[model samples]
Target: MLANPALNKLRQQIGCIEETQRRFSRTIPVTEPVDRWLPYGGLSTGCIHEVKGTNLASAIAFSAILASRLAGDQGNILYIAPDRSLYPLGLLSYGINLDQFLHVSTRKSQDLVWTAMEALRCPQVSSVIALLSGLDLTESRRLQLAAEASGVTGFFLGHAASAPIASPITRWKVSSVAGKPGQRFDKPLWTLDLLYCRGGRPGKWTLEWHSQALLPIVPQLPAKQAAREALAG
Candidate 1:
């Protein structure tokens, strides 16, 4: 009898689960919490998410948060950067431990994409972050396939000025936002926008890295300011 592909995949997943359970000796949550703005609660396993930005720092900041969250207590993360060196200090500020992560540098964009796909296929790695200059439909599909095969999460970072719309499970755009000058560090403020999601609506929110926490900035006028305005009117 011919082996059923579905059954084969099920068996593979069961094996993976058993291996992970044995190594960790604990049950980890299946879904990691992203932003409430994200649809589907968080990114699903075996899926590809794209982050686009003109500012490299903004993109890295967003990806770092996802990586740290998915890494959990003992999970491992792999990062492929083709544009520049992965700054340990920046990642530390974002609450990611450089010592606990794998950083791979590639020469070309194509190599970066392929390496990311291969890393995702590795059973030992829980998440893969790929920094690519650009990607077409074919490349995106290939990465998606690898993600599915290994049940790994993939994050693709695209160029800041040019971001082609590829078919990813979720797509986010990060941009600089105005902040109070001289109020604190020289780091720029940023906003994260959910441009496209397979199972959620599109929305935008401001974000700030403060006191080692990635806090979402709620936009609202102060109550005292509103009251004073009302009295003046």
Candidate 2:
């Protein structure tokens, strides 16, 4: 006798939930304040995360920080940025080891997307970060499935030039914020808004990516301290 279709579908959903729970039981470390809104007190390792590039500076900084933390020093990270203008030397201040990065510098968005999808399917990589312009629902679903299958996390970095694409488990919007005074360059401050989360309430937080006097940015203390240091000098 054939089983009921509706019951079979429900069973499939339940199984997916259980399996996903088991796979994502471990969480990637995030900033303390930001972690509060995340499920399981951290970002899931084997999931797809979205970071929009409305403010290119903040968006890319946010992605780099997490990718560095998650990749640690062992696992490979595939970064597909077709038109990335970032200086590789400066990324070292953010704790990103150049050796662990596999940078895909392409001239076309189509090739970038293809490379990202393929990277996501590879289990050896810990994470795949792609700066893609256009993506349809079907393509997003394929990427999502690939991420799930490999149990490797993915980050889709998009910009306002194209509407948001992909139904990721979590989405974030990062924008630049003013740094304290006496700072020759801003300290990479950003207001992070958690646009959506699968099992958590959305909220916002501010983050300052600590850095030394790296190129494209210079060192400075918090405003008050900087003022005092200046006065003493």
Candidate 3:
């Protein structure tokens, strides 16, 4: 018996698709707790993710950490925003390699999105952090596709809790959690809510950001407040 030509062609196509998926599905390693919680050990590259919160500082901090980790020492990372509000020095605490970091500030919102989409398509760019006020499903899908093409990780930092965009692989909502009275100078605390994960369950956690990793901390939320936030998430 001989193999049919059509069957051979179909096998070749399937092999190519599997190879593409394996290439794009490589994940950036994250710390414990969060790492164990994630279906994968860490976030998958070649995908768009969103971080939202009332306190932009906490959200931006988290995004910076992820971007820095994704870019490592040699890869490039682009930060796109309306203004030059994200100080490079501030990101130093997050272990960001300033030499590999670039910030592109645009006055118009549309320009910000356009710049991010272009950056995501750049093979030299390992990650892109875009501060977007709002993004519809269409725009989100475009960014997602761009990342897929270049195997770059993209982060969207949204100001408020906007309508959930469908294209992102995961959506996280963060908020500042007050620490002990005299521990203000200690590590800042934040409540991280995994609002929506494409392949995982939603949950909440208290995390303290250090120079190297995200360590789980004790929850500071009251039972009632925690319940409300959980429901909202």
lDDT (CA) for every model shown?
0.72, 0.77, 0.82
Minimum summed lDDT over a 10-residue window in model 3 is located at: 179-188
Best by TM-score: 3
- Model 2 TM-score is 0.78
Off by over 4 Å in 1: 1-36, 181-183, 186-188, 221-233
Cα lDDT tens digits, model 2, 91-188, are 67677789998888898867877898889999999888888777888888889889888888888887635577768888888877687676534357
TM-score against native, each model: 0.73, 0.78, 0.81
Tens digit of lDDT per residue, candidate 1, span 65-145? 777777767777888886456677767766687766988897877787778878878867878888776678888888887
Clashes of 2: 0
lDDT of 3 at 197: 76
- The CA-based lDDT of model 3 is what? 0.82
Model 2 residue runs over 4 Å out of place are 1-17, 184-186, 211-233
- Worst lDDT window (10 residues) for model 2? 211-220
Locate the minimum summed-lDDT window of 10 residues in model 1: 24-33
